[model samples]
Target: MPGKPIVSSNNAICLVGGAPIADDAISAVFTFVNSFVGVDGGADHLLAAGVTPAAVIGDLDSLSDAARATFAQQLNHIPEQSTTDFEKALTRVSAPVVLGVGFTGGRLDHALSVLNVLARYAERAVLLVDAHEVSFLATLGHVAFTAAPGTRISLMPLGQATVTFSGVRWPFAQTRMAPDGFTSPSNEASGGVVTIETDGPVLVTLPRAHLALAMKAAVRAK
Candidate 1:
């Protein structure tokens, strides 16, 4: 069974999953998110934190009876085993950008799976945010954003790509990158604005403070 579709007026939505999410992080998500979608056990977390999501989407495997009772109307169960709950929600929702909390900072495998989903869904602008960092898949285009000087920026190739980047401590001019080979990590932004141009998909990571800039760039990239 697949989940019911969600119709959202807002272009951006927050996805709360079953990972550790800080209180401040939840507060920050609510500040910008026009709606919330809970993934299975994440609905329990949201309810525990006094948040009622617009919809709860998952395979119905991890959600508790108490959570189900509390938000029965919001449950949209998808009984498929092929995809993770995060991917299921991502495929079902329509948004210009999706802010993901509680999807990272968990078990290493889970975090890696989230990144894989971001890569697979390159057409969707999804930001996987944790306490310290924000990551998104960079598609074919020029992504420019503002960040503080000395802020950490990392670029990991999701697939085969040629990229050119500037406004950072180390600049790459038409550099070839691939998943099996090169990755630029621990790079620092040199000034207020940083830009990266890629012919294929890559993952861009930055400090959490630059969430607004990342979101802006993602929207522009779309």
Candidate 2:
């Protein structure tokens, strides 16, 4: 169902925010780790799903007394104007790897900001999960993926980092990629394994069906 999460994580945590997060998406947390929190509406969602938050962050603007009470012990009130609560969670996360869901797919502005944040903090091990895709900010290391022969892997540059890809339909050895210059998109996999190696920021998009496998690989990195 839409309310039950499909994947879970131990290396990753989830942030519930102002927008609507699917139940299936919520259940996905079971596949990973158990650490979760309510980011305003996200808290309410947690309670609705019968999941208590490990923490509740944000300005406490949209949070209610009930949601607050539900996550009282886990509540870490972050009253900062400099960044979003979602960012605070990502920033404070000490885990070696973090998988994120419910960060996108609700609003365009927030979705775009998620990308911006991913770019700004490419050094962090993070993956953004959406309804249709799973993306990570391609950083200085090697990102490897194995997709169906017809599956498409596309790259879009973010910030100061450059993208040099290999093992894909389009190849780049050591190339600088920025928002203004050459772009990589609609690239197809060559059957075995598809690897994208870069030193900066690039958005790696793949179908939702591949997210489970992709996340597993990302967390397995050295």
Candidate 3:
């Protein structure tokens, strides 16, 4: 079961995770989301950057001694082994959108776990940002955005999905996608505007440069 919200906000909230995060990539996130929550050891990252998170939610397995001491009042420990720290924090946060960093770029298994959480919480508008890409759940069933010609757009289905696309180099319609079957990867925008519509859970990924547009599409989908 999902936990009750420990932090709620009208604006987007950024969740910092324990995985490695690029300095520039993490900095860019702060521009879009001023409010922040730390997922366990994520609080250590924020402290290093000299930013204080509103709350720290996780199992505290990876939390650093300094972070625990510094954010003593903000600490929120949920000692559950059923879910990853990312899911623990994500479920406890309420916001218009959730921007996550440091959830990728570490162990491949951990990154995959993050994707699983995104699919499980498909109704929530969440974006996972890495050094080179911005990824999110295509919960709206349809998403439209502009990108320069040849910009890469990848879609991976979390469940069975039928999809259609336009303004892409290899546009397709009624394409069935599933983890066990075909998945769309490295498709590029031909130019101008690109649109994608899906009937089931799908993950969309784009270049980091298109973060703003990705965020807009996620919010609009919600």
Candidate 4:
């Protein structure tokens, strides 16, 4: 008898819509969730990544005729006039978290739109993972991390953030990033856990490679 086929599971979904996705971006996605979103052009990114999208949610404007044809039969085809396709996809997926690449980095307007979605989906635990950084619409909690001794971590404030950290090159205790906050860029890890205390949504980003490794570890643990 033939052996059974191997089946791998993926909860970490990647969205490659249209934001100039990085070459290494696909490595982070255990599963690719296609969103034929308009404005962001995420549908194009989906096909380019060679991933058979588990779900393609979006309006029809962003997708090219050929792209639409490619996914014609598979599309979930949400025609809601109010929600963006990206938002539509996020609503449909039941995953614990999402790593949304190609959702940033193209047009400035599109990038801003992605941010709006993040804020709206803040309660969804969706992390908008992009080439340059990972953004989250945090509500109330602490974000912590432990990486190899010398990894660099950067925090850019979106909304006001009351931040604190240790085990970093530059440690700040109860620091606030206000309307005009410090850059706090290029801080290195100190082989221990770094914590950020915040009451609202703040954009935190680190090296994508480290996050990819961590996500892989998470899958293995599960």
Q: Against the true structure, whose lDDT is highest?
A: 3
- In candidate 4, which residue pairs get closer than 3 Å at backbone N, Cα or C atoms, i.e. clash? 17-41, 17-42
Question: How do the residues 39-149 of candidate 1 rate in per-residue lDDT, one tens digit apiece?
Answer: 988888888888889999999788989999999999988898899999899888887889999988778898888888888778888898888888888757788878778
TM-score of 4: 0.77
* Candidate 3: residue 195 lDDT (0-100): 88
TM-score pick, better of 2 and 3: 3
Better of 2 and 3 by lDDT: 3
Positional deviation of residue 55's Cα in model 3 after best superposition, in angstroms: 0.4
Q: Which structure among the candidates has the greatest TM-score?
A: 3
Evaluated against the true structure, the overall lDDT of model 3 is 0.89
Task: Tell me the tens digit of each residue's lDDT in model 4 across 80-143.
Answer: 7787667766666655446676777778887777777775555655556666566554335655
Q: Kindly give the stretch of ten consecutive residues in candidate 3 with the minimal lDDT sum.
A: 213-222
Q: Candidate 2's residue-wise lDDT over 198-220, tens digit each?
A: 77677887776787766665563
**Candidates' lDDT values, in order?**
0.85, 0.70, 0.89, 0.60
Q: Which stretches of candidate 2 lie over 4 Å from their true place?
A: 1-10, 172-175, 220-222
Global local distance difference test of model 4:
0.60
Give residue 8's error in model 3 in angstroms: 0.8
Candidate 3 lDDT over 1-222, as tens digits, reads 365689999889999998988887668888899688989998988999988999999999899999999999999999989989999998898898999988988899999999899888888899999889999988646778888898999989998899888899999998999999988888998999888889888899999988888898887443
Best to worst by TM-score, what's the order?
A: 3, 1, 2, 4
lDDT of 3 at 11: 89
Query: Candidate 1, TM-score vs. the true structure?
Result: 0.93
Q: Tell how far residue 144 is off in model 2, in angstroms.
A: 2.0
State the weakest 10-residue window (summed lDDT) of model 2.
1-10
